[model samples]
Target: MATPVLSAERLAASYTYHAYRQLIDDLQAEGKTTGPQQSELLTNYTRLNVQRMHRLDKTVQLLPELREALAALRKPYVWLIITEGWCGDAAQIVPVLEAVAQASAGNITTHFLLRDDNLDLMDQYLTAGGRSIPKLVVLDAATLTEVANWGPRPATAQQMFLDLKSQDLPFEEFSTQLHGWYAKDKTQSTQRELLALLKSL
Candidate 1:
């Protein structure tokens, strides 16, 4: 028998975008920034992502290509994202995803699930055999069938990470370099890749 598929409906019922944002806020209120399982570096990074998300949520501009693609979407879909408060990549990407879902104008809705809390689901969407996070699993709301998926980071960023990883850079150095790339890119690469993914669906 095939492995049981987790339903988008269940995940969405567990956590919506608003709930995820609130989770961050609650963490910040408790003088914590990262998830229970993460390190101090992730704490600081998570704080930055919170600020970034707020700024991007207000000012992130969707490229014309993404806008047009979203406009052409007739079928409704669910963007079920697996993430956690400590995930720096999720902090950067989730806001942009929310922007995309908003631009879809009722054609799409976004949801969130903490990676640790949803390991069974995350295992199915792992990045290169590791439980790397911020995976976006797009599904048909009516059937809970996957439409498309994208995650962790844009291709360019992922490659940069891989290159640095090959050198076995220290965690601090690796994070600094990775975040530096994210700062410079300003999420353009992410938007471009997600647009392509959506268009293909």
Candidate 2:
């Protein structure tokens, strides 16, 4: 049998974007990261992600068209985002998503769930069979059923990742290049893609 769809109760239990940020902050205070695996490396990534999120939250600007679209949305939707604190892409992407939701004039709400904590859901939305995170499942607020989804990374960034993976570079070098891409792109790709998604809905 197929797995059951996500439920309203699960969304209720999930963290709001604000609470999720605070959870990461609290974990940082304890020298920890989200997920079952704990390590110095993962903790270090979480530290770096905190800086990334802080910067993005302050700097990401939505396009006027995207903002207009969000403001015009009439139906209520929930953006259920699956991510982890140590996820670099999530750090880069989640803030932009929050910005979009904030622009939606109460039409869009966002909830965050840790990928490891929601493996069943994560499995259903895997990127190439891997549980790549920052997976966004857009649900109809009234029915709690999926309407659309996007994530792991923007299309351009995902391609960059595939290329880097093929090259088999060290994690540090690989990460630096990937994040450099996000830094240069400045959330434009993310917003544009979501704008397209919104138009289709």
Candidate 3:
């Protein structure tokens, strides 16, 4: 079997980062989110995610090493991100990705696709047998071949989540601690990991 590739038509139908952000905002205004299921909890998460994204968009600063790696790119890449508005991890990480692509100085372009709307694609990039949001599929611009991928969360964060899960903590408690970790880390772990990823590529 061949490695599945994203069709150009699919890429064309995906949202730009700005458009994705706006879509989330628009949905939140209507007390909704980005999937088939609708509920107050999801809506509240969507609202909170909007705020998280807004803050990261304005406040995220790329590390110098990551900035250099991004700036040194010789070829262009497309970062197709799988995400949904109600996802807490996506809220914490997507804006930082946009910031990295923007700093790439045309070497990277980003497109966003909702996981629910793109299950065929999402299934190909599952993390731990689960459809994890904010999963990135980096594609070579010319060939549309996948080059590298990263995401859902940094390794440390993922470990923390797994540890919390092992303890059988309630969703509310674990989520609060996770967000607190993100706030304290301030994107450093994410930046370092991506910096290494870029160097390897």
Candidate 4:
């Protein structure tokens, strides 16, 4: 089956990094924020992750290798992210991605589409048969062809989740351990995996 072409104009109309930050702020101000599959606890966690990512956006410095890789890109591409305001993983990963796009020196443009509102696009990039949030889909701007994709979480974190799943732990315990892993990671695994994806492309 052929990969579906995502609408660039739609993506352009979607949130920019700054706009996404603003949306998160607005949602928090409303005293409520919830996605399709999120519970109250997850919603609260997502808010916290958004705040953490905002801080990271200000302080995240690219390593030398990543800098060189981003700097070397000559072809134009779109780093299209599918996410929602109440997705904790998206909050953690999106800002790091935004920082990378900024360092690309205009070779790449990053945009975000809310997954709930874009089911067609979301279905094209499902993770493990599930609609995982914070999916990063790289598209060639000129042709709108999807070149690569990465998402949900880094391999290390995903493995941790699978291990936790095998134990059939309670949702509260599972989420606490999962997010604690993300807290300690500091986006290193995310950056490393994305850098690898960029190199392959």
What does candidate 4's lDDT look like per residue over 1-201, in tens digits?
444466656766888888877776777776556445646665687678777787887777777889899987879889888988777777778888988999898988998888888898899888889998889989888888888999888999889988999999997799889889988888889989988988988
Report, for every candidate in turn, its global Cα lDDT versus the true structure.
Answer: 0.83, 0.92, 0.91, 0.82
lDDT of 2: 0.92
Among the numbered candidates, top lDDT falls to 2
Report the C-alpha lDDT of model 3 over 1-201, residue by residue, as the tens digit: 335368889899999998999899899888899999999999998899998999999999999889889878898888889999999999999998999999999999999999999899899998899998889888888778888899889999999989999999999999999999999999999989889888977
Query: How well is each residue in 74-120 modelled by candidate 2, as lDDT tens digits?
Result: 89999999999999999999999999999898999999999999898
- Report model 2's TM-score to 2 decimal places: 0.97
Q: What's the TM-score of each model vs. the native? A: 0.91, 0.97, 0.97, 0.91
Candidate 1 weakest lDDT stretch, 10 residues: 1-10
Candidate 1 clashing pairs? none
**Best to worst by lDDT, what's the order?**
2, 3, 1, 4
- Estimate, for each residue in 1-201, the C-alpha lDDT of model 1 and write its tens digit: 332256545754767788888878887777676445756666677787788788878878889999999999989988888888877778788899999998898999888888887788889888889988799988887777787888888998899989999999998799889988988988899999998898898
Better of 2 and 4 by lDDT: 2
Cα RMSD of all models vs. native, in order, equals 2.2, 1.8, 1.3, 2.1
Report clash pairs, candidate 2: none
lDDT of 1 at 121: 88
